[model samples]
Target: MRIWSQCVKELAQFLRDRLTVALAFILPLLTLFIFGFAIRLEAKNIPVAVQDFDNSPLSRSYIERLYATNQLQSSRWDGIGSPQAALDQGIAKAAVIIPPEFSRRIKAGETSPVQVLVDGTDVNNARVIRSSIEATTRFFVRNSQLQTNPSLIQVRSRIWFNPGRQESLYIVPGTCAVILWIYPSLLSSIAMVREKEQGTIIQVYASSLSAEELILGKGLAYLIVGLGIAAVVISISVIIFGLRFAGDPTPFLISTPIFVASATMFGLMVGTRVPNVTTAVQAVATTGFLTALLLSGFIYPLSNIPFPLSLISNIIPTRYFIPIIRDGFVRGTGWLGVWFYLLMLMLLCLLLFNIARRNLSRMQLPD
Candidate 1:
């Protein structure tokens, strides 16, 4: 792939300048470390898939009791098929299996082991699921004393399309979106600005290449870099975070390039406006990175933002991009849930490209 060449180029550039070495490697790692320690969102509305072998009144009652806690929600099992299948498909966070003798043992003054297989990819959420199960089991045990009824109805609810509440499910996709967007754009910005500082941009101004061609060519190169970044980041996420695809990978597969192109154009826009590499890098680091990270709902909800800044979030590409990514990995609704967001990403990409094209065109001087 072109990424190999790009990597070699990047290594050469970093070797040529120590400042480039710090910018290329150190900054990105710091960003990831900051994200790791700072983010601690509370878990709620977690989906628990049920495979009740007992299918008895007591088992159904336990399911109902678990759902009542509000911390745990129902998955798509509907009392049929393997709970493991749902977990494998990313349709549930935790699976509960009640053994055949569950009710009989409880009624006979014996304890029963209700199997709970939790998705451990998200360690914190796994802990929450375990705690919620224990508490609900205790509550159900206490409540059973007063109920003489021999029958109980199942409690079934929670986003019907499917579910998985692993923090990595939500975290990886959004984090990838931000990383893919910011890094490619930052690289593009720095490259173009570095060329300007070296006076090589004058060669482009005198060449047959139009402004669109020049900008598009630069973006195309970095787009390859962005996709490479995606592969490495996603692979790392899968190995480290244990995240898996929740649905058809088609939507995510198609949209990544479009999202990266928009990001590259955005960086080119900065390079076009600023005369120096330092200003271009700062513009990307402070304005571009902060806006994409904060406004995109990567780590926080858009609704939770203040009024003035909330309005600004609507224009942020990550605002639309994050939902599509979250849907593919966390919600498993496929294209149905993400089609609108995908369309929005396309629109934003076009908008950003037009702005970059115009800005670069304005910078060209008469011969």
Candidate 2:
């Protein structure tokens, strides 16, 4: 009964703070909008410069094939003397230099080398441009009279997951993990710290509530709020962005509460350590947000990160939850496949909640 009363008081306090209420409701949607629209992984319509010194039908044919792929767009650099000039002036991301002997070399069954110059400024864009140019050139050679060898090996490729390569398909599910990590911890940490800063915590301490009851009450309030925000953001992803859940939603349903519990308890731990709301918010932003952003495989894969840094990612609870969300939602994998991740999340919840309970119990109460 006392715990229920404390829970109600926490909810009332949370509802009364206009700033916390606004952030609790508004921040998650705003974050989803920013991540959905602003950040993009796939590059398209890369501008390319074609410098054909041959000026022959073969060179023109090659240039036409590049445009047909729809990945590269030819840019006219009139009076730009050379392809290098176009590249130097930022007129094109890539340049194709066809030698005067291109057709003759091909007709004579000799090796013909075409120089492709790519701007290395943006590594990802440059890699895509190089691959597209190579694929297009290979396709042209296979179809043209230049291919005389009957024994030459040919390769066929197909992409499995995210076949259309839509960036949103990869990004939206990850955004859910990022959003859950930020808001739950931030809101709960600020809520607890606000009570400390305003001296309201003394009243609660004097009300004969046990430390465990106090922690559970505060955590329950934010857990409900966090879950509600998650539903809104997820609905937006499905309705607005068309995010699909391929796997059984059972694993996701089971894992989310565990993940949310860890986040809320983490915030409680932060709240107990910090002296004021400002410090708590900053702590959550720097520790929770940055750790989830960098270490959770949201922006970069954990396998790709080098040792020591990669070692740090192992402990981040968000790291475990991301795979659960991606596996259940994007890959449609069953519980057997995602059981490991769910287990990790459950263990983290237990650990964080235990630590938070202990910390809250030890906090010095005002007389």
Best by lDDT: 2
What local lDDT does model 2 show for residue 257?
A: 81
Worst 10 residues of 2 by lDDT: 145-154
lDDT of 2: 0.85
- Per-candidate Cα lDDT values, in order, are 0.78, 0.85
Residue range 1-367, candidate 1, lDDT tens digits: 3434444554465467776545544555455545543555767789989888898887888889999866888886665568898888888999988899988987886778888999999987899899989878866875778335435774556854334545556666777778877887888888879878999889778876678877777777777767777776777667777767878888888888888888888898888888897898799888778988888898878888999999888778878888877777777788888998899889988998899899888888765
Clashes of 1: 0
- Per-model clash counts, in order, read 0, 2
Task: Give the alpha carbon lDDT tens digit for every residue of 218-314 in model 2.
Answer: 8888888889988898899999888888868989988888888889989988998899988998999998998898999987878888888898888
Off by over 4 Å in 1: 1-38, 43-164
- List the pairs of residues colliding in candidate 1: none
Top candidate, metric TM-score: 2
